[model samples]
Every structure is written in C-alpha cells, then in structure tokens.
Target chain A: MIWKYICGSASSPLSVSFSERPRDGQVIFNSGVYLIGVKSGLLALSARCPHLGCQLAYNAADRRFQCPCHGSQFSLKGHRLKGPAKKEMTVLELRQDHECEGYKVIF
Target chain B: MQQTADYGQQTTDNNHGQRTTDNGPRTNYGQLALWAFHVALLTGVILSFHYRPWGDVFKSVSKISGWLPYGDFLRKLHYLAGQCFLILSFAHVLEHFLKETYRRIRPKEWSRLVLLFSLGFPLLFTGFILKGDKEGILAGEVMYHLAQEIPLIGSGLARMLLRPGEEFFLLPYLYHTVILPLTVIFLLDRHTRRLLPRGDWGWPFMAFLALLATFFPLPPDIPPYMEISHISGPWFFHGVQLLLRQVPPLWAGVIWPVIPLLLTALLPFAPPKLSKWGKRLTMAAWLIHGMILVAAWL
Candidate 1:
C-alpha cells in the first residue's frame, strides 16, 4: 500500500497520478522527476528520464534534478529549464496537512 | 520599403466586400510538424515502458508484464502514436514538397537535410528489433549483419555490439527513438521558422496523441524477435532499410532521402515544364518507394 502523508501546507499542481507503476517493460513514458519546493523542505524526484529510462537525482545546490547518464537537469519546481531533458518534470502534489511534519514524497 | 497591397485582393471582389483585419503573422508550420513529431515521441516514450527491448524476452506477454506502470495501455498508446507519427511526417513532407517549399531554400540550407538519415527507416528498424520475437530476431540479425559489412569499423564493432545473432536491442531502441530524434529535432531547429500560436496542448498533445494512439492501430504480430530471414520494418521505413541491404547504407539511408530536396530547392531555375517533370518525379519516387515496400513484405 502507498503510504499517504500530507506535505507542508499548500498542496497544488495535481500530482497524484504520477505515482502509479506499470506492468513494466516498454511502454510510453513521459517519465520525469518532480523538483518540489515546499515550506517544509527539499526532496528528490522519482520520475525516470525520458531519454532512456534513467533515474534522476535532485541537486539541491542547483535546485534541480539531474540525470546521471544523460546529465539532464530540472529545477526545484519540476520545470525543465534545461536540456538533455526537453520535457518538463512530472509533478506529485505536495499535500500540506497540519499533522504532517516533514516534506514527504510518494513515488 | 514600398508596400504594394494587392488591390485585386480587395473584399469588394468577394462575399465580405471589406478589408478584413484577420490577417496576422503566420506561424511556423515546422513547429506544428515538430509537435506532430513529438506526438509520436510521446507515444514511443510510453510504449518503451512496456516493450521488452530484447528479442528473447518478448516470447510471452507475461514475460514483459509488471515491468511498466500501466504498461498495457501505454504500450498500445505508444504504438498508435508512432503510427501516427509515421503518417504525419510523411504527409508533412509530401505537402511541403507539393507546395514547393524547397524552392525558397538555397542549396546550403537544403543540403543539411542529408544528415536526417532518412525519415522513418532507422527509427522503425530499431523499433521492430526491440520487439523480442521471431520477427524481431531476424530483423536484429539483418541489422547486425548489415552493420557487419563495414570495413575496419564494421566487423569488430558489429560482433561486439550486436551479440552475434541479436540486434543491439535496447541500446538501438533508446538511441533511435529518444536520443536520435532529439538530435534531429535540434538540428531541424536551425533551419526552421518561429513558433505558431496554437492550443496550449500543441506541445502537450504529444501525450494526447499517445492517448489517441490507442484508437487506431495496425494488427501487430507477436514480437518478431527470433529470426526474420525476410522481415520488414513499418512500411514507411522499410523502403529505406531494404535499400541498405543492397545499395549500401550511405546510398539508401543517407544520401537518397536528401537528393530530392536538394534538387527541389534548386528546381525554381529548372524551367516551368521541368517543375512539371519534377512533380511527376516526386510521384514516381513515392510510387517506387511504395512498390519497394510491398515487394519486401511479400
């Protein structure tokens, strides 16, 4: 089961469906990472790079997600704003609930 | 610059009978073409998640299952999107050529098209090779063997890369669909026009096409991965691949697709009847391409 937790206090961008997994193999993928900024903190994107299904890492210093193999980067808010990553990042809604403590990402 | 507004185009000559203000700067049709191209790209991206990439793995649908998130639907979407891409790119080119767009481009600009490596061939070549079935295997073999024909670079590289009997598989698929197309798109930008004002989904419709791809599809065989002594790529690309098998890669895959554009770009000076001849030549070229594809499938 997917663990559900609300993020900071403002949840927007409608990023819920990004968490679903597929049968796995070769299917269509607009796979991209979500670089999210919240009142709570920073987190890495779970979306795969469309280049070759390579996973991306979040570069907090740069405030972006970068693909290891292709070296594509995305900003903290998931806007591409970069190359080797033509498409924009996939967004996961950052749910902000009063009870939620830290920035929790579900992927 | 003295502007000569054509009095002949006056609204008085037509039903509206007044100067209409609807005229605005035209947008880049190339960008629209790019959007169409991206639709196929999105379809391909979604499909990649379900595809086996290696010919051996495609033996059963069960094998590839659980690999992707929402793989089945996306896979179908990808296939349909690719098919649409194939259709649209050709239609885009066909319409452009018919309109004599090349007439305006100089030799220098027209020549750059040679690097495109042929429209659908390489993409489809690597695409079918990733299917992981008997047909895919044969296609892989064809591609492997074809690559092996290179002199110093050919033999060693093919063996090292293709795994003898199999296609380079995933690597080619990843390269052809993603890396390569992105490259082509990048290159095409240098020779294209400004963006057209259209729907917000103009770009987002890449995904929409994939979603729509589900509606229209060609009947797919089980992956042709094992061994295709005689296999064909999607009908569009096969015309070139079949050429590479006999005419050498440089001739069919590289040089041929561009020569027409080069000639057409220069065609404005070739006398009016020559343009007539050129149009016929294009029709003939298209006809020959179709015949060659049909022959290969047979």
Candidate 2:
C-alpha cells in the first residue's frame, strides 16, 4: 500500500536509529499530529485532546500534550495522565519513505 | 333600638371611607407604562413577521417601513412605545429614589428595579444594532472590541457573546427581540404587582397610546453607507460613548458602567445602620451619572 507523505524527514526530530531513546516531535500537517520516537519505532498521535476536542499543544517541559480549552494532560505515548478527558489520544500509523527521505503518516 | 341602628350605620360608613382612603386615586404613569409595554410588544411581533435579522437587515427594515400597507405605522408605534416605556420607567425609578422607597421597607424590591433599569439600556443598544445600518454595525464592532479589551477572559467572553464572521448580527437580534423583552416582561410583572395590586386603567391607556401612535409616527432614519465617526449611540448610551472617548476601554466600557449598577443592586441589602449613607451614596452615583450624561450631550 502506498503511504501518503505527511511531514518532511526534518520535521520529526526523533531518529529512526534503534539505539536512541524515545523523544516527542510535533508535526503540523493535517489538524495536528504528534510523533513519538520510541525504542520500538515511531508512533503518531492526533493532537486533539479527547476531552473537549480542543487542539492539544505539546509541552516540551513536561514531555506531554496539554489541552488549552480544559486542562487534560497526556503522556508522550498518548496515555491519559490527567483529564477531564476520559480517553487517550488517537494514534496514527507512520511509515518511512526512502525516496522523499521523510516519514509519511498513514491516516 | 333606634340609637343602636344609627350606630351600626355610622360604623359601616366609616369602614367604606377607610377603604377609599387606602386605595387612593389612580395615576396615569403606571397605566401609561403598561399600555406602552403592550403596544411595543404587539408592534414588535408584527414587525418580526417581515424582519430578518441577518443578510441585509437594513434593507429588510426599509422594505417593511417604506412598502407594505400600515407597515410604517406599525414600525413607528413599536419605536414610539419603546421610547415611552423607557421614559416612564426612568421617571418611576427617579420617583422611587427621591422617595427613598427601597430603604425603609423593601430593599430587595429596589434591587430588582435597579436590575431591570440597568438591563434596559443594553436592550436598547442591542435593538439599535439590530437595524444593521452602518452606524449600527459600527456600534457592534465597538462593542466587540470593547469586550475583547476586558482583562483575563476577555477574548473568550467576547467569542461567546458575539458570533464570528458575517453572521455576527444574530446574537444582538436574538437579544433585542426575544431574550430582553421576555426578561423585561418577567421583571415588569413583579415590579408592577409590588407597586399596584390591580391595574384597572388598561383600556383607556391603550386608547391613549393608539392616539399618540397615529399623531406622531416615528420616521425611519436613512441607513448610512459608510461608518460615520461622529455617530453616537442612542441618547441613553451617549455618556458611555463619551466616557469611552476619554478613558480606557476597560474603565469606561466595563468598570464605570458596572460600578453604579452594582451599587444600585446592592442598595437594598445595605446594613440598616448604613442605610442613610447608602441612600446618599445612591443619590451621589445617580448625580454623577446625570453629570456624565449632560457632559456627553454638551
């Protein structure tokens, strides 16, 4: 299946290298997508906070997503840390494209 | 037996005299207010049949005013009745204030009256803006920006109060035609009952309003194409506009307008020992308001 290109390779700050520790990256393509680089691979999550559907902003200091409308906090991996929001953030699938030298996010 | 019969007759006469003294003669003002309220409401309902709040309100208003048989008359009646209601209500408030009616007996009643009175101006402002003329649109923009200037949650509050984009006209229209009238009616019912147990002069008052509406029909002002800078709001809001020109939006628009209203609302709840001071304070506040109004006019 052909994967759609979402963000440029430089957009995701996380390296595809297996040895590197996981870090959070925010890519603004459609709505908002957050890329989480982990030991296993790269994970993409929707930036919309589940609680009130407000766009979530990535908090670099806390390494989590925080909602602006209501204070709902989610961990880098989309786990609900604190919420008026009951559920976790929606995760998206992303694939690496060698031709574009960038990660293509699958909707 | 003859003496006993005379005494019983005298007692019955005294009771009848006492009842007459307690009821007092009917005043024209309250009746006038009642009639005006009804006339305004009726004409407003009639006007609403053709008036659309959105998409060229000025044109819609003009169509109703210039075209349709008796449409101009109905619109005039509505406008005149609203003015009459405001005038009568202000007179009533002043009468109560001078009489110190709220302090000795029903403070809460006084507060309710103040609340109703305070609400009237905003209702009027909203009504003017519903015209959707250039001046009216300008007023809306002024209000939106003023609301946006409020500290802390100003932007959010503004967003909640005003609709975004071209549909901005809807909120004020809803407020003017529906929300405000309903609220005023609810408050007026209570206020009227507190003042008079029975309103017996409805028919005559209605007749009087009809006569007034016929003789002095309200003429619609031409809607301006471009925003005229000199254009002020309705006379009642002239003071606020003047104040806004001088002071910061936060002070003139929000705080200054709010303080007097707050004081008026809390007047009835003032401590008994400070009741005298409260009355003085209230009077002072109103006097300041009067001065501002005069200055605004000048």
Candidate 3:
C-alpha cells in the first residue's frame, strides 16, 4: 500500500492543447516530456540524453538540444548530432485528442 | 624479506603505540578523516529520518531545509563532514605519498586505502544527487548513463546503483544511508586497524563542523528551467566533465578516471623504479586534472 502510494498509480497519457499549432523550432515541456514543434509535426521527446542520461535542455538560439553532462547535442528533430550520446533522443507516441483540441502524449 | 620487515615495523609504529608525537598533532590526518566519516555517518542517520526518497524529492528536501527545526543544521553538517572526510583522506594519502611511506604499507592494506578513497567519490556523488535539485537530478541521470557505458553489465550496474522509480531517489538513498556507510566503516576499520577514532581530533573537528554548519547552510536548489550549461558537477567531477566535452564517453567517462586510480593501485605492488614512475604519472595526472577543472570552471 505504501509503495503504491509513494510510486503513484500507473500514469495516464497527458493531453496538451494549443490555441494554434506550435511554431516551428518551438519546444514545450509537459508532464516530464518535451514536445518540439517541427515541420514534420510535434515531436514528443524524452528530456533524457541517449548517451549518458543527463537532462537535456533545448537551445532556442541554436535550435538544438544540449546535454550539460557530457556535452551531447541533438537536432531540433531529436537527431543525435555530437558528443557521447550514441542514439537519437527517445520519441514518445503522440495521438490526436478527440475531446481536447491538442494531442495525447503517451509517456 | 627486508621489505616485509620494514613494513611490519612501520605498521607497528603507525598503528600501535604513541599515536601522538612531540611535534605532530595528537591525531594524524588518517585518524581525523575517519573521525570525519563518523560524523558524516551520524549526521546522515539523523537526516535520513526526515528525508523522503519518493515523490517530489526536491520539495521534500526543501521542507527539511526550511521547515524542520535544526534539520538544516544536521543536513549541512552531514555535507560538510562528508567533504572533510574526503579532503582529509586526500591529505593523509598526500602525506604518505610525499614521505614515500605508502610503499612501506603491505600491498593488501595499501590497496584497501586506495579502494576506500575511490569509493568516496560515488558515496558523496550519490548524496549530492539525493538533494534533488536541478543539478542533482540531472547529475543522477548522468551517473545512470555513465554506468550503462560499462558494456555487458552496464545496464544492470546502472539499475543496481540507481533503480528507476520515483524521482530516481530510492536506490541512491539506499546506497547513501545504508550500504555505503557500512562499507566505508568496514574499510576504515581494516585500514586504521582501530575500532574507535582517537578522541583528540574527533571532538575538535565535530565542534568545527557544528560551527561551520550553524553559519553556513547549503545553497538553494535551482529549478530545471534555469540555464544549466554553466553549471558543473561536484568539485572532483569538474575535470572529467571538461574531458567529456573533448573525448568520447568511453574515454572520458571510463578510461580517463581509471588511469589515475590504476596508477595509485600499482604504487604498493611495483618495484622501486616502477613505483617511482607510477608516483610521477599519478602526480602528473592530478596536475592535468587540476588544469582541466580550472578550464571547466572558466
């Protein structure tokens, strides 16, 4: 009972609504996940670095995600560019929300 | 045979009678460091009573810092003492290194000291992460990934060190509060060959830590959204962080840190000429590490 309370219940998908489509190169953080607005569509990415799991920060000026830990860099589209990170950033599934105007991000 | 006799004499001289010298302090740095570790362990026990390893760890720590009476004092003391333990242990090793006495200690005993010193990093690092601030959380994740870089056992090692769960705090907390302290105490006992610390430095150091803790509290937690590119890891980690920027993860994260450690481990076992070279290489590594640390900070 205590473990369940502390760990919390299984998480539900998070829905985020936007007044309009997010601007290209824009990044939004919702429910511990980051969503990047790209030409392809909204790319829901984990803030975790694929190299060594450092928290990644999206650099707006460079339009790249930078990891402070090992200096790994990823593109705006979650592609690994440089440093120790071997794989592309983990992308979460995004589904259109019928009831809500935005998308449901499955974490 | 002669070396063995010399080692026996040195061990007896160092460990047995006359802990104090006419010129030297009542306690040596090795003893002082063990005392500091004791203080850190005691204060850590107190802090653990209030610290929650699940849910919003940052918020839990914030409450302990702000709301709990004397909680901040205990927390700061734990932090300060842990740092002192590492610093003083380094001083003890430096003293031995400079006097060329490290080679006189039995190879097994000397290796124990090496292992003890090496263990201090992860122990302190885990404690640093338990604070659950932006830096701490990120650092914890970095540690997890670094562990994963270990090849076959990487993922398992990572899980053992820091099991993924609520805020990734449970395994770190377990290691910090329980496993690490026990292991440190056991190693310290074998290295010091003493069940209790010499009271001389212990009491004074505790008083110093208490005063320090009273006046100086830990810095406030920075939110994750704040610019973190400028933020670095713990002090000892600065050099590695700088190296990571220039090299691949396997080299910077694994091989680089291991070089100095490997050299230090070789000190007691090597022949005279080889030992001298080992010492030189270790010192050079430290000097380079210092430069890298400065570069990272800059």
Candidate 4:
C-alpha cells in the first residue's frame, strides 16, 4: 500500500491544505500515477485523460487537470468537467496505514 | 434556349454546323454516366475474379496487383472507373441545378438525384474499407466507434452493419460490390430515361473510357503495418473528419452529414417564393463543405 507512505498520519502536522497556487507538494510516482494534497484529503488520480489517451497536466491556477491534446478538464476528485472526453479520470483508492508515518494506496 | 410546342422534341445546333433533333443541349452527361457505369461494371467483374472477401483481403489485393498478369491494370481500371462514375454522377446533378431542368419540368427528380448523389459517398467509403489495409482498418475503427456512440441503438447497429471480428471485411465488400452498385444502376437508368429520352449514346464513350483507363492506372495498396499517425477516411469524408476533430462524435459523425442531405432532399418541396434563397443556402452549404475539405487537406 503506497498510500501509507504518501499520505502522512492524522497526527502529522505536515498535511498541508490544498491551494490554488503552484506548490511543490504534488508527487507523480509514474506516468499515470499522481498524488496530490487537496482540501478534502489526499487524492490520487490517473493522469491519463479518457478522451484520447493524452497525458493530463495539473493547472495550479485552476486547480484542475487539463488535457493538452483535446482540452478535456477534470476536477481534483477525477470528475470530468468539460471537453470531448466521455468519462471521468480514474480515481485510485487510497487508505491510511496506522503503523506507517504516511498513507497507503490500494491497488 | 429556344423551345418547341412538344416538350420531348427539340432542335439543337451540332458541332458540324447542322441542326439535330434532340432533347435540349446534348451535354453528354447522361451518356458519360452510362459509359462510366459500364466501365466500372466491366472492371469490377474482372477484379472480382481475384479479390477475396474474407481473411487476408489485403494480401489478395496485393496478389492481384503483383503476380497476376495485367491484373494490376484491371485493378487500376476498376478504381479509376469507380472514381469516374462518382464524378460523372456529380456533374450530371450539377448540370441539372445549373440548367434548372428539374425545376420547370420535374421537381421531384432533383430530390431523387440528390439521394442518388448522397449514396455515392457511402459507396466510395465502403470500397476503400474493403481493401483491409492500414488505412482501411483505421477507417473501420472510426466507423465502428462512431456507430457505437449513436445514443441507444448504436451498438446493435454497429454489430448488424459490421459483423463480429474479421467477418467485418465481408460487409463492406457486399455493400461495395453488390448492393450499392445495383441501387445506383437502377436509379441511374430511371434518371437517364426520364431526363435524356434519347438514351442510346453508343460505343464511342466506352472507347474513350478504355483509352483513359489505359493511360492512367491506380497504384497498389500499401502494407497494413506501416507507421502512419494520421489515419484519414476517403477524400469525400475529409470535411466530416475535420468536423470530428472539433466537435463530439455524434454531432460530427452523424448530424453534420445528415443535415446537408436532408436539406438537399427537401429543397425541391420548398415554396416557389423561397426558391432563390433555397438555392443560395444550398450553394452556401456546399461551399462550407468544400472549405472544410480544403482545411483538412491543408
């Protein structure tokens, strides 16, 4: 469970609130795996836009994912907002590990 | 532009400075359509001897062009003749519009002609898809996806239109070879009989088509595994393809094409007072279509 290491414990003061400004807190483990700290909680999203398999870029100013190829937009929760993409971005399941210092992602 | 008492009977000046009894100006479009149809049929028959409908269709097409003697020539002739038929039919329709032949005498004929003309695009597309090459495969994929996206009955329609798996190749082959050709020929015969009563435009046009076929032969199909990024449909569909990139699949793939066709079919029934505006609108629609096609090419 990778989420355990990514998402800090509930007692940890390091859990930063999500902001609309550019931050260094976002972590991309691989091409499609992305981990970001949002106001709701730690959100993990598959960066691939469902429209045409183009990689999505996170826009800090808008706090949304935007596809460079077809301009498909998605919210922080992986819900599709606009553009030609028919489906939402895939949201990966994440869980907290009590023994670890961070969170664990359920594959 | 002089008229006689009998609508069927008229006199026209010939190329040799002699007055000939015929129906209006003999633009020979009907004759050209007849000849092109014949040439297409002949070449299709010849190509059918070698073209297999099922598995490895691309290979069979290649074999026809590569191994069989004069097979390549026949294939090219068939391809060219089909293209010629499309062009000739379009020209015939345009001539009717320009001459206003359909308005004064038979208004319904224009709608029928438009229907027939509309059928030509699908015929051409199905022919291209039958090749089963890289481009053909891509075209099939586009068609399948587009069909699948059509709201409720999409999946069922796609399954019916393009069977399951490799058998999909057979559907377009049937359409290109049998169904569409027969329908076009039937409509063409009726159209020619009504418009050009003097239908016997003899063997000279056939000879001309033969000469043209001999001079220009089509190239062979490319291999299926080629590295190509931009897969496009037939030229007539280029405009729609352009639209597909900009809009949603349903709108671009279905609605855009259907709109023009519906307008063309309904144009003849428009009130006489709106005839001028109707013609302008139709022309503008075609102009927009042409522009989209040009943009796609660019």
Candidate 5:
C-alpha cells in the first residue's frame, strides 16, 4: 500500500509540515537537506546528529547518517551506534507517497 | 546550602569503606586556598566602605580625606583583597582538577560549583565597572554590548543599562558596586555551604574582611576608559572571553552554547576508547586550559 498526503495550501515540496512523537521518530521540516531514517512500517526520525546539534545527512554509501561534530553515527532506523549520548536517536513520523507529483505535506 | 544537605542526613559513621587518615597534606592545600580567600574578602569590604563609585573627587582620593575613620586602610584593603579573591578562586579550580574532586562529588554538587562560578564572576564585573575609573568605563562598555548579545530581551535591557548619561560615564553606579554585588554575595554564601557541609569557612573569610582596611591602592589603571579597547570583566571571565576572541563573534557567541551538547554526545562514542587514554586526555585538557589561562594573564 502507498501513502499519499493531500495538503490544502499552495506550498513548496519541502514546506509541508511533518512531525512525530519521540516514540515514533520526529520529522523536522527545514530549508536544508536532512537525511531522515524512515521505516515505512514503523517510524521516521530527523537525520540530524543530536551531538553538537549538526544537521544530519544520509551517507548512502555507508547507509547511516553521520554527525559532523565529533562524528557520532546513527542507523537508518534511528538506533544510536555509540555513547556520549545516554539515549538513542529520536523517532518521528513519515508516510510514503505512492505517487504524488510534488512533496506537499498534508495534515 | 546547609538546609539542602542536612535534611538528607549526613552519616560520617559509615565505616564500611571510609578513608579517615588525617595525612594533613591533602587538607592543607584546601586550607591554603581558604586563607587567601579570607584575606581578599577582607580587603574588598574595607575598601568598599571609603570608595565612592563615581564623583568629582575620583581625580584624587581627596574628598575622602580625614573623613570616615580608617578610610585609608579600607581603601587599600579593598584593592588587595580583590587581587587575593581572584587568585584563590582560580587556584581552587586548578587544585580540584588535579585531585579530581569532580569525580567523587554528586552531579548536583558539580552543578552547584558551575553555578557559583557563573555568579561569582558577575559580581566581580559589577565591582570593577562601578569604580568609574578608566578600567571601570572600559569594562562598562564591554558589558553594555555583551548584554545586547542576549536573545529576545537584550535590546531594551542593554540600551537603558546604567552609565552617567553624560556620555563620559554611566550613572547611578550603585547598581554595580552595592546592589548587584550584595546580591551575588548573598547567593554565594548559600551556595558555598552546600558544597562543604561540615566545613566552616568563617575565620578565613573574616581575614579578608581585615585585609580590606589597608590603603589608597588602585589597580594598574592601564588602557583608557569608555573606549572598550580591551575587555576586562574580571580575570577569570577574561580568560574565557579571550579564548572566544580568537574566533568570530558568530562562532563564539552563537555556536558556543551548541558546542557543549554536541561534545557531550560525540565524546563518549568518540573513536578513542574509554580507557586509560581517555582519562589521560581529560587530564591533558586540564593542563592545557591552565596554560591558556596563564598565557592570557601574561
């Protein structure tokens, strides 16, 4: 099954709002590119490295989001690879658009 | 501080694993620092009694003539005490780092130590700028701009912040010298008690009171006032500020708050294993920080 969101207002693809609770990964909308780790069946978490608070990017080659500051790594599903942070990566929400032309976020 | 601790119940009799050997040397270092602090406090108080924050007589300690009893000694003591206070506070930090006092204390205690440091420096800032001399004026300028750097509420606060409106200096100097400093002292006493529950710091503290009785001593008086040419809030603060000065304003002011959070998370999982090497690194950092402090002072 494919997920589709139909938002009302006219907005750019990146402008759509996507947010999820900590339990489910949180989707943070931003101007910069973020490597979000999404499990279609389960969760979505913003791709930023919580350490040093750097915006995280997906390293497709490595299949993980790497933090620029101090280099902490997180798995695609938001599981933390190491310490320094007592907790795991935050989870957010996401839905797969089976076939939406543009990434317009809907409520 | 006492109230916060005693309520939890202190049990010195826990003999299961206690080290009560009075080797005396370990305690002596702490005691020496305490002695210095007492002397400084003494000087600061007496000098404050004769000192006028701002007035025409500032050109010379003249109007303060044959006036209030022991005025001269009070003034001298103030300057000397300030120097002593600065030295002890710094030495205390270094000694703690060496002995790893930070390791055994409860996190709550470390947090209190941080808070005391943050508050203590501000008191020193107030004391300096209120003097209204060259250093005071220069210090005030730095403070005014720094306040502006605060987020949402900074603009209004910084603009109206005290200075003599005459453009040459700020007015109502009482805010820095008397009002703010007193508030800091009150808070600091409560804080100190919490860290050293059974320890009594009074006698040594009183010695600082005595030192405040000595001379018409003024600081080096280097650099012009109101120019903001050099930034000297208090020596302890100056070191931090100087380190930041090496970087751009955006980096120092904006990026700094974020750095700690990132470092905390990234450091543990850092490539370096949490072994003897990690401990060594932390110690190295301590030494490096001290060296930097000395470098800045020089």
Candidate 6:
C-alpha cells in the first residue's frame, strides 16, 4: 500500500505542439519531461533515469542522454545504449492531435 | 608495588603474587577518531542553531554562509570535523584489521564496534543531504532509488528514509541532528568502555580544521539546471558511484555495501579458514574500491 503511494508517478498528461518540439538530435525540457526530436520522430521521455531516478542530462554534442549519478546513457530515440539501467528510458504515449497540430503526451 | 600506566605497558599480579608487565590496548587511531567525533558533535550542535530546515533550504544555508556572523567558519569547521571523524574511524577499523585486534577483544565488543562503524555511513550521508544543494539533493534521490531496488521491502525502506513527494530536508535533518549521533554515542561508549578520548588528541585535528576553514570555504551551491556534466556524491561514495556504472543498482547500491558488513559480522564466529577468507575478501574489496574511486575521480 505504502509502496504504491511512494512509487506512483506524479505527473499528468501534457500536450506539446509540433512547433514546440526540439530540432533533430536536440532535446528540450518542458515541465519535467524531455521532448527529443530524433531522426525518426519526436520522442517524449521522462527525465528520471530508470536506474536510480537521478535526472538525466542530454548531451547535445554526444547526442545521448546521460545519467549524472550513475552514467546510464540512452540514445535520442530513448533506447538503452549503455547501462546500469536494464530498461530503456520511459517513453510516454504520444497521440497526434490534428486540431492543435500537436501531440498529447500521457505521462 | 607502584606501576605506571603507559602505552601498552600495564602491571598485573602473576600467580606467584609477583608484579609482571602485560600488554594492554594501546592508544591508537580509534582514540583519535573518537576525539574527532567529539569535535564534530560540538560544532554540529552550534551550527544547527543557524540552519533552517524549512522552505528554501539552499537559501537558508546560503544565509548561514553569507549573512550570519562567523556562520561560514562554523559551518566549514563542522564539515571538516565530520569528515575527519569518518576518515579516522575508517582508519581505526583498518588498524584493527591489520593488528587482528578483533581476535583479542571479546566477540561482543568487536561486534559492537562493527555496528558503530556502520552507523557512520548514515550519520555522514544524512548531513550531506541536509545541505540541500544540487549534489546533495541528487545524492538523496539516488539513495532513494537505490533503496527501492531491493526486492520486497525496498519501497517501504526508501520511503522511511526519504519521504517521496515531500520536502527533502525534514527527515534527514531529524536523523542527522538527533538519531544518528545518539546511536553513535551509545555504541562508542559500549565498545570503547569510554565515550571520550583520553588527553587532547583532538585539539591538533581541530586546529588543523580551523585553519582549513579559515582558508577554504565550501564552494557555493549550484542550481540543479546548470549544465554541469557530472555530479559527484560524497568522496566515500565515489567507488559505488563508479560501480553503479558497470553493475545493476541492486548489486552496486545494496549488495556491495552489505558484503563487508556481513563479513565483519561472520569473522568472530566463523571457522579459522572462513575467517581468513573473509579478511582476504575484505582487503580485496577495499583495494578494488580504492581503484574505482580513483577512476571515478579521473
């Protein structure tokens, strides 16, 4: 019971526009979320690292998200590149909103 | 007959009623560590008066450094004294390992000393978290998730140590100021048969720290959003920090730290061969950890 309370995510769904997305290979942080513009598409990732939840910092030069605490690295597409983290970065569900020309990110 | 109590020399009555010299426990790093603990406790108490745990803890700490009279000096002194206490305590344990003092001491007392040594981690770490700086906050978060990596009870334990979705400093402040110090004091008295060190071994250490505080004020706290590529935890955590890069958190955070404590616990009761193996493993672990620490720094 208490575990559920402690582990539960606090963020709600966020709607971000296509224009607001970062350029290719770049990442923009908006309200605890990382919106990365990868070569394929926009990837919305939770800023918290899966390993120890230390905030991940995007290295534009290296084009990888690095965990400052434990050195877990993820690709621009949110794939696990190097780890202590056994899992890839948590990608929120993105639904296209034709009306707003944007996507609804379910955190 | 009259005798002098000096170093390891002590006079004891032989079976024939003649006085004979016996080697007692000598003054060692343990005593010096205790003295450092005393200084740390004193300065911690004084510094607590100026520290505000509620609302904008970073700014509150900044005020202690920038606004209050001699607050910066006192804070630095407290930080240095705490570090010395931890380092000297480890050195004392190392000296014991080298001397095989555990063999001579009663198993119960040795076990108590082991517990005392283990307590140093939380005592020091909670204080580090209470600083409310970027490194400290991230370190606390790391600890939380590390604790959460345990199988069944992880979440409960993590929540107990650090309240999730809550202001960070309150619980850590309580642990740092009250619970840990009292536990340390009790264990120190039980293990050493005295709470305070004899003579003034601590004064020189304190003097050195005072001089250091005068010259080297702690670096200003940086905000979390800064483009700092690497955030290091406390110096003692470097090895684990590096290890976490290579292994899973369950191994790096939980199992690795517990291995030494388990070995220390088993040493007194294990068979001679097992004890020898335990000692060897402990030494190897420290060596690897030292190398890893160096690697993390580089």
Clashing pairs in 2: none
Local accuracy of candidate 6 as per-residue lDDT tens digits, B1-298: 3322222334453232333233344655677778778878998898889888777788888888889899889888888877877887777677667666566555665677778778888888888888888787888899888989899999999887887454577878888999899999988766655676765556776688789989985856776556567888888888888888888789988998777776775567767768778788877877877787898788
Candidate 3 CAPRI grade: medium
Clashes of 6: 0
Ranking by lDDT: 6, 3, 4, 2, 1, 5
Which stretches of model 2 miss by more than 4 angstroms?
A: A1-107, B1-28, B193-208, B215-224, B227-229
Which stretches of model 3 miss by more than 4 angstroms?
Answer: A1-25, A79-88, A91-93, A99-102, A105-107, B1-27, B224-229
Error of 2 at B63 (Å): 0.4
What is the docking quality class of candidate 1?
incorrect
Off by over 4 Å in 1: A1-107, B1-32, B46-56, B59-69, B111-117, B148-167, B193-212, B216-218, B221-232, B237-283, B294-298
Instruction: Name the runs in model 6 displaced over 4 angstroms.
Output: A1-26, A37-43, A93-105, B1-25, B217-220
Per-prediction DockQ comes to: 0.01, 0.02, 0.53, 0.06, 0.01, 0.61
Residue pairs in candidate 3 whose N, alpha carbon or C atoms collide under 3 angstroms: none
lDDT of each: 0.50, 0.65, 0.74, 0.66, 0.46, 0.74
True-vs-predicted CA distance for residue A45, candidate 3, Å? 2.8
What is the TM-score of each candidate's chain B when compared with the real chain B?
0.62, 0.82, 0.88, 0.84, 0.60, 0.89
State the lDDT at B259 in candidate 6. Answer: 78
**Candidate 4 segments whose C-alpha is farther than 4 A from its true place:** A1-107, B1-25, B194-208, B215-220
Candidate 4 residue-wise lDDT, B1-298, digit = tens = 4322122234452222323344333566655665766777877878888889887888998888889898877776677767767787777767656655545544455676787777777777887887778667657656776787788999998876677355868888888889988887777665544322244453666666667767775644656654332456787788887777578878888777777677766777779899878777877777788898899889
Candidate 6, residue B112: lDDT: 75
Model 6 residue B89 lDDT?
73
Tens-place lDDT per residue, model 3, B1-298, is 1111112122324542332222232226777787888888888887888899998888889889889898888889989989988888777666666666665556776677778888888889999899888888877877887788788999899888886655489999988888888888888777755647764556878888899999995866786556566556788888888887777777787778878877776788788768778889889987787788788777
Worst lDDT 10-window in candidate 4 chain B: B2-11
Which number leads on TM-score?
Answer: 3
Q: Which scores greater on lDDT, model 1 or model 2?
A: 2
lDDT of 5 by residue, B124-177 (tens): 566666555555554565556445656787667766665423433334355545
The CAPRI category of model 2 is incorrect
